[model samples]
Target: MEKREHWKSKFGFILAATGGAIGLGNIWRFPYITGKNGGAAFVLIYIGCCIIVGIPLILAELSLGRRSQRDAVGTFKVIKPGTGWFWIGGMGVATGYLILSYYSVVAGWTIGYFFESLLGTFRKMGSPQAVASYFDTYSASPLKAIGFHGFFIVLCMIIVIRGIQGGIERACKLLMPTLLGILLICIIRSVTLEGSLAGLTFFIKPDFSKLSTQAIFEALGQSFFTLSLGMGAVITYGSYLTKKDNLASSAVMITFLDTFIAILAGFAIFPAIFAFGLPPDQGPGLVFRSLTNVFNAMPGGAVFAPLFFFLLIIAAVTSGISLLEVITAYFVDERGWSRRKTVLTMGTVSFLLGIPAALSFGRLQGVHILGKTPFSFVEGLTANYMLPLGGLMISVFVAYIWGGRKAIDEVKVGNPVFITGRIWVFLLRYICPFIVAQILLFGVLSEFTSPRVISFSEILRYYLGIIDIVIAAGVIIGGAIYIISIKRAKRREG
Candidate 1:
């Protein structure tokens, strides 16, 4: 067997994990969702979700990985043999593969736009409509789209092939700080623009009336997705952690840093959007179309345009590395593949898988799966179904099958007397699983039903309210009673 590689330092592990968490979603998706979901109200709700859901899951995955000293699939096998629970890890590996496949295509677009911004291409386009047209044309070109997609995949391959200390850790150390530095610069420039305060006001002020059931669920989903949980990326990174590294503090730091960057990204982009009088809810095009117009019109636009896109590329690459790593680790741990063979083979295959998504914008534009483009279909499948289900299963397995007592013992390896083990396990055992199951159920219903007939939120509000209340009460009461039993057991043991 090949010797396993470990992270060189505690800080290296934190940076790499945080880099994985801070991805394109943070750049493009989170801000727009915040804009659409009542700004500060949604932001506060999201923070609460992170505390209640995100950290416990992180701790769960990390402790499992480190304790098993294996990849996601292997972690399950090592921990619990002769059972089907390893399929959970298999699902996670598959989820990472699917997410990274098309994700690289979008990452490639950031690379393409970075160069275009550098060459003053957006400067030539006078209106957001003009920039939107240019984006349409550019995305429609099969050659450019696939070429950059391949390019980004190759970049990920290069970094991951070098192994952990020399590659992922080293790259993330440089990338995360640079990402933050550039983000700070963008925030400064964005807020200094004339009339930028309007954007800031819109972003920071809470309007409770604007908050809806849909917005609450969106916040829950965003908090879950933004942390990169349920996909085995965290598990793979955690497998590299040393026994001395504190899982609790590390999870907290990673979550805090990731959320901070996401909020700062809003600060960076929202002020510019409002200053230019662009609609806040510009959807996915907020980055490529709306921001390009902002860069074209704002003072010192030329210099910051490239910086902004470069920041995006770094963000994409960081997360891309994690997704690719999840797949690569599987092969290395399970199949006895060398790092080079695993990275090269899997990265190439991922790039090939992404080609259809890349071409979906251009040559494959007419093709639709289940009434959506290839890119949209795959993105929806992973985000809506696979990730949430994987997360829900992980929480259930750790809390029930693997047993929360075992999980807490594993987590206590670095911090022997940590008091929050009960709390963490309570959330992992009860709260996280229930919420993620709701997300999964809601996503399925939303996908299959015509919102024109009856929306999923409406179903939740009008039809399922009593059942939801019963489930919530049961979980809370069950968790509290379970905690008391644990306390009694500890007392007897003492």
Candidate 2:
């Protein structure tokens, strides 16, 4: 087997990992989630979740990766030669592949919007309606959207093909600082708007009254999903680590930078959101539509319009490349494929897979498997089920199969002071799996049932009739497998 590649420097790995964590979701989703949930109180819950759930998972992923020095799937196999543990990594690889398919589609939109911003398209849209129409026109354009989608894939392919140090790390090192600088300029301009203070106040002041049970799960989901947790992406990145790198500090820095950038994004956007009198809960189009109007009204509209959109594209690309690496890492490590072969094969396939999602807004708008856009349908599958399941399996596999002592030893590689053992293990053993299971159930159940408890009977009917079928089948098949295995073991002994 070919020798594995490692990060050239610890800082480079951190930046790359941070770039992965800081994606389109951080830019677009996090602020809206915070605003819609509990404002600053939601932010606090989110922060707590990051500390309790997100950071611990990050450490687990990094420790697992650096110790095994393999792709997500390979890492599980390395620890336990023949077991269901490998499926955990396989699920992670599939999650990364599945998410990236549609993720690249969104990244492509950012790219198109960047050019639109450069042409001052957003600057002329003086009203939210006009901005919305503009976005609708652009989004509904099949040729333009798919063109950008294909282009984004090719661009990511370039970086992934270059090998770790030369490709992924190099792009992130440049992208991170540049993204921060552009964001700072936008924040400065946004805060200077007349009513921006109200928005800032809205964002900073805690309102514990708004933190509901659903919002609690929302915070956990956001924190878990935001940091690229539960996906193989982090573990794939971690696989490139050298022995000298500290997994704990790297995970902490990645979390800190990712969270800081997310909050900074809130500061930058909320001021504009309130200052312009836009609706804070406008769903996915908030950034592209309403914020475009805010950009038009700002004094530095001409400059920051392009700058902000450029920032969006940069963030998306950095994230897109990182996800691409997960699939690339698997093929390269486990299949004896070269970097170029893996990148081309996986990148092309992902781009092709994304076609339906890109077309979902226009060509396939009405096409639904179970009353959801193709994009949204896949997003739900991966985010709700696949990603959380991957995270749950990882926590369990590390805590039980690898054993607590060995897991800690992998984590304690660079630290003489290993004090995080007790709590981390406890969370890994119990809390994380349980939280993830709750997230999966709630995430799905919310779609079919109202958050209100007005009709318990209706929910129970649906749960028993539909949900229980999947559960029952799983149990039945699992029991059959166990019985068959036991009988086979007895035969072998005889």
Q: What value does the lDDT take at residue 96 in candidate 2?
A: 84
What's every prediction's RMSD, in angstroms?
3.4, 9.9
lDDT of 2 by residue, 85-164 (tens): 78888888888888889988888888898888888776665665788788778877899879999999999899889988
Q: What is the TM-score of each predicted model, taking all chains together? A: 0.93, 0.90
Off by over 4 Å in 1: 450-457, 461-494
Give the number of the best model, judged by TM-score.
Answer: 1
Q: How far out, in Å, is residue 314 in model 1?
A: 0.5
Best by lDDT: 1
Each model's total of backbone clashes: 0, 0
Give me the overall lDDT of model 1.
Answer: 0.89
Task: Return the number of clashes found in candidate 2.
Answer: 0
